[model samples]
Target: MNNRIKKIENNVQDKNSAAWKKLCDYIDRVAEDGSEEFSPANELGYELFSQIYTLPETISKLKKVKKVSLYGSKLKRIPPEIGQMESLENFVPYTSYSLHWFPYEITECKNLKDSTVSTRALYGNYKNRMSFPDLSQNPVRYSGETVNCSVCRKKMTYDETNQLWISLWVGTDVLPLLANICSEHCKNALPKPPENYIQKAHKGSSTLPQPPDENESFELQIKEYEREQNTINNP
Candidate 1:
């Protein structure tokens, strides 16, 4: 298995474990109380690091939660069902090193306001660049295998879909989100990415514009500083 999948598998939690029970309890509490702030990481005695993947279907039940924190968890992906949380306002997943991207369905949360993500760990992050998975141009349906469109959740065949990647700020932190769409129409329906990011979705490849070289950037800064010092002395 590749390193990414390996990391995910390593963090998978057993459903019957004490940690899972604690997570369940927390979820129930949030659901019952309709609490505005939910931070599973802060729960006492709950070792969340071992639970790499979240039960997205279970999380869909947190309809009344406004803020969700998964800081430092080992999550690999967010469930597309997160869009169903109509009341969700803020999200914090800072330092989740294994999470690479988000599902397009998160856009369904109209009230979402802020997000905090670990940008360095994301696919195609500006600071420590990483490559994104190449999406298939012609998605085909395999007998007995089904994949839903990331945007509409409609059943889609491999031949009928298109895949693309985009970076957007769901709350405060910018996240690289992936879209598996049924048609060009769904692709076009995606919202614009956050300011200072790529303006549109593009295929993941080396052809994408490269970020500025760190060494070159540092040299330019030094040059500017030297020019400023020279001007000060002459004046």
Candidate 2:
């Protein structure tokens, strides 16, 4: 495992999905376990997550692909268009420690069957300790905002009290954060995932993080929300 990590850390390609794709290909052929998917190894180095955070456009282009897997890529997010892959079936984003959730667009893949994610890093992950990324820092305008699912995009603002954080915990290892959840069905579908892992309760976008989910236990919990002020009095 140490050697594998070293290989991944040392072999980071240009920080794009294409570069990650090469690593993905190599893992499929060489992974000791023979699983087509493998986790990110030490081959990568500092700031790996920063390099590939913006490559969703490239990942979405592989639409014809059925089975997909990415490990140790240090990805911070998955493109909402990832749901555009109508042919998708199996997913293996195991060991992508940096990812925390998946965009609601993932629900669009009506045919998707299997998934292997890093549940710990997910926003609503078990025990919920991973740091949540600050939404305030994300640019309000982007190419995918207009073209992707309108509900999933975080383009509109509401009375801050009414605003809610939409999150999902799809995999057990790698939980790539989704853009947001803007609908009731999105919320309901999550309370009980159709397959794989068990469902845990969590707070919704409308709730305060300090209190967490006053209702139930969530499989993955978004422990914190980005606040305008660092402290709660300002929060």
Model-by-model lDDT, in order? 0.69, 0.45
- Residues 87-153, model 1: lDDT tens digits: 8998888888778777777878899988888877876565655666545432222223455787768
Report each candidate's C-alpha RMSD, comma-separated, in the order given: 5.5, 13.2
**What residue runs in model 1 are displaced by over 4 Å at the alpha carbon?**
1-18, 44-49, 137-147, 157-160, 194-196, 213-235
lDDT of 1: 0.69
Q: Give candidate 2's TM-score.
A: 0.49
* Cα RMSD for predicted model 1: 5.5
